[model samples]
Target: MIGLANGCSATWHANRIFFLTVAAYALAVVFAASHWDIPLNLRIYSRPFLLFGFGVTVILFVVIATRVMLERPARLFPTLGRRLRGYDVVNRLIVGVPVALTLPVFFSLFTSMKNGLSRIVPFYADTTIVALDRAIHGGQDAWRVLHPVLGAGPLTFALNFLYNVWFAVMFVVLFCVTFSTGDERLRSRYLVAFVLTCVLLGNAAATVFASVGPAFVMPFYGNDTFFPLMNYLQATNAVYPVWAVDTQRMLLAYAALDGPRPGSGISAFPSIHVAVAMLNAIYLWRFSSLLRWLSVAFLIAIELGSVHLAWHYAVDGYASMLATPVIWIFAGWLSGLRRWPVAATAVS
Candidate 1:
């Protein structure tokens, strides 16, 4: 611990705090890694994270060493030297959050890849898909009208991504971060929560529910509307298999031609898009009541788009959406336990 002129460094000797934090973080990383189950990708991301962490630690030590050398003892102890130490813990916390979140989901998924879990029914869950199919029975007509409009033009296709709602939500989150207190410790915590939740939703989507969207699988009409967008993504990830699969699904969807495409019998149930969007809505509410409403609206649009576009069954959207709000509430609760000192100071 460092000895300050008049008092203890408020953040010095914070090692114990981070030890607990890192332990919790390690557990989450394990969960994520097992869940994502992708080894190659995990390695690809970890290297940069490690490098960044190392660079930050080095800078922190340099600063602390300089402080210890120059800082004088209190007037009462003029003959004594001031010592600077234990500040590196802060740097560790700074980078630990994301590492904990991403690595675990990736590992957890990779771990489960063998049970044929990667292709399981949520990727392949049966009963859930059946329930989704049932909902499609009554809503098909209502959806047909909405679906065509969504796939009709670039404007509609852009709207299909729920850009308006998300764009609004992003600003709300940004503003909250901007105005948060001087302390970022807790803000970073919640930020990590959101990042992990979304990553989990995406990784799960990739592994469990790889549905070729309505635009691709349904033969209702020519998917020229959204196919172009899907095609662009395909071109974007021509290198990565994960991306390649997404693009192919879109092409398969374009080929399905809009009338009645075969939903990837293997994928469907639990719409990831809804899960993620709704989660964003839930977390954004951490900022303001206005954000809550925006999230709610986005939730609704994402749900509607899922079915109208036939990328997901109504049941799947409902299930995925449910988890989102639940996860958001949890994330908010945990974040609430701590406050951003910097954020609070700034706001004050």
Candidate 2:
């Protein structure tokens, strides 16, 4: 087992870069929020933070209690008492406390920056992305190619459901990693990669490649190139409750408002949905083969939904698929982590 000093040093190394990165990004978000006159409402943002924090804590407790009860029914309470005092639990506490601070601040700033995008930089990439999408899809939009098969009301609704499920899956993964007793090196890498993926691709590249996506093309650019797809979705909504259509309308409303609301933002190009899904897949690949394939399938579905739902161009998912691994590798390198020896007991 590693010594306390070694563990402490490793923890510092694991989190050092993340802390610095978040601090720097927080300042950047504040500057952007100021530019848009969006005040950071701790009340608005902390609600999700508390939910995730408490939700995950309760989940961990239940899982631990269940496992202990199953294995040693009479010793459940005693086992929990001992395990709660164990180093693994201690490690989770170390990570959890900081995450409690970071998560809410991160959410508030993320919403602010996202809501401020149009004010900061008008979307001018839709036309170019549209052309590139057609070229990539052999002279037709990606949705048109997929529509022949996935355009039915049931299929559209299913895809929308899977698309919306991305949020839950994202938070589940976040909490899992935050409280995980797995390999500390990998845990740290995943956390770092997660933040960078959102910041670099979600905010930075999004600003550079601002596009309103297929659904908003008419509203933002007065272009009808995607009108067919949008019309099909609207028609499908009459039967299937296409939530994305309503969500898009809500985001547009939020964008028009003076203050940032939760989940208020518009971005297309290098889909963050696809990017984070791929990141999860990459992180899970090492643990379980079944989980690996499941994540891959989920990633595929998310990419398809991004296009089929008119939420992203095909190339946006393509960029995310391509760039996520590169960012993961860069995060691993930046974390200064070496592969944990297979025989080594994970930080506990």
Candidate 3:
């Protein structure tokens, strides 16, 4: 154990915090699985791992090829060789592959556990959450407010596309942060925040709230509270394209057929989509002003899209916006607690 700890301290350095966080998260996932009687299926992670690996590999290859072509045009092979030999390149591959694999593997298990446990929970809080949404929106359905300005048109289509892009955007950010050799502190902070947001807000909060959101409310409870909003989305789907409609249908189908599978889980009290986007925006705010603003805009679009697309109440997004920053700040504090002096000594 001492040797292993010393090795991790030396090899991972300050980034050990992320590894430790992942470890703790994995343990929690295991406990949840056992407690919830959810079966562990490693196969659930295969597709996601392959997709993430392929995307990261292609992006990295393009970046390196571009640099080699532009900077060392005359000696491309030599430049490429040198780049491959660099510590950053080697470390990124060595450290990144494991981190990337770890995320999906453990997260899949966690997600399965979350879905199964959600079913065991006594009640769905759709009515309470909907009431909260109404209070916040001044008794107006959020989609109604958005439908007027966004309308069923090109803008709505674009936003739907962007909303679906969240999956890719999230993976890209995780890839960048995990593979980053330049900024250890930043990387640690982001990873910690990401894990905490998913586990705390996505899993814990959702479990406690135990609500299915607007999309599933009618199907699950036969409540027409959000029927008009769903009708509006269905109408928009006729003219423009909304991916959420299809996704919600698929999710409901999966829920009915298989209960809860790897890539599919249903809980909507505080939208993880919105929380993650806001978390990304907060972290980006520390780096680039432009990227930060773009992230915020994307977050807003996600919030609006969640409502307009019938996936969530407006309050779901609002709660996420309120919850994620506290988690981010807490992650920052936790990352700061890494003892660099002890780590250096142990490594030496």
Candidate 4:
């Protein structure tokens, strides 16, 4: 127990923002479980935790291997040997491994609890969100407008691929930011923003809004308003095989099960996918012009894909894009507080 406390303390000192975020997530889970009678399922998070662990381990190995390869042949093994013996490497492993492990657990709980609480509230904002979407798109679905230009076989496939790749992209960004011995300020900023976005925007805002998005509207609300959109997507899936369609179906089916399943959680007021993409883009803005532009393009693509794929309403993406910047700014301020001697002492 003392060793465990020490380990946790070290982790907190290394990444206070992440630890705090996880604590907040835990409290939220407890509150939800007590109030809503939501069961906490540790089993659901096991597979995803394993997958993320494996992926991050491979990525770290590749990065280290690439660095070793870049060295002169004469110095390669020596350099690798030195790095392996170095205090920095050992310290990073000691600190980073636990963080990497805990993040997925926190995320799983956040998602699961959010999904359970969403159902408990029993107030879905699908109609209101769709109305907002139509209002913004001049009384027409955004997909209808975008379908003509981007609904082609190749573009649809590409968009679906890109949309689905958001998870991988997010993981890469997260792994790099969390574990890489890069610029401390940049890393802290990104980490804080990410936590704030997931907890404050992704879960909290989603709970307040309580929406099921475009994809689950029919099943949840019996509203056929999005049937035309769904039918169009089914046709596209027939031709090009969009992954979002299948994922949406799977999530809906899981949601229909008896109780809170491990990976089953759904709410779609402000699209967390777009919000995270936008958050990353905002942070990447300071890196370089080319990266900034690429981030912006990716953000736009995600926004479009979120709508066109029928996973979200147009307004869902809009709200996410708008809210993300504010959350980023707030996170920045919170990160800045870490610089204070008092804050540093507290973490220590």
* Per-model CA lDDT versus the true structure: 0.46, 0.83, 0.78, 0.77
- Backbone clash total for model 3 is 0
- Estimated TM-score per prediction? 0.47, 0.89, 0.90, 0.88
Name the candidate that leads on lDDT: 2
Tell me how far candidate 1 lies from the true structure as C-alpha RMSD in angstroms. 11.8
Between candidates 3 and 4, the lDDT winner:
3
Residue 191 in candidate 4, Cα distance off native in Å? 1.9
lDDT of 3 by residue, 1-348 (tens): 987665454457746778898788878777877786666665577787788789778877888878878885677888788876773675676556667767777677667766665655744788888777778788877777777887666877888898889988998888888887777667888899898888888888888888887778888899887787677777778888877788889888877754457668788878999999998898788778899899989999998888877778888888899999898888888888875566555444
Model 1: per-residue Cα lDDT over 148-222, one tens digit each: 455444434444446334534543453343224345554444454544454455445445655444444423333
- Clashing residue pair totals per candidate (backbone < 3 A): 48, 2, 0, 0
Candidates sorted on lDDT, descending: 2, 3, 4, 1
Best by TM-score: 3
Model 3 weakest 10-residue run by lDDT: 339-348
Q: Which residue segments of model 1 deviate by more than 4 Å? A: 1-40, 43-123, 126-133, 136-142, 148-151, 160-189, 192-268, 286-293, 332-348
Inter-residue clash pairs, candidate 4: none
> Listing every candidate in turn, what is its Cα RMSD in Å to the true structure after a full C-alpha superposition?
11.8, 4.1, 2.9, 3.1
Q: For residues 285-345, could you state the per-residue lDDT of candidate 4 as single tens digits? A: 9888998998899999998888888888888888888998998888777766657553443
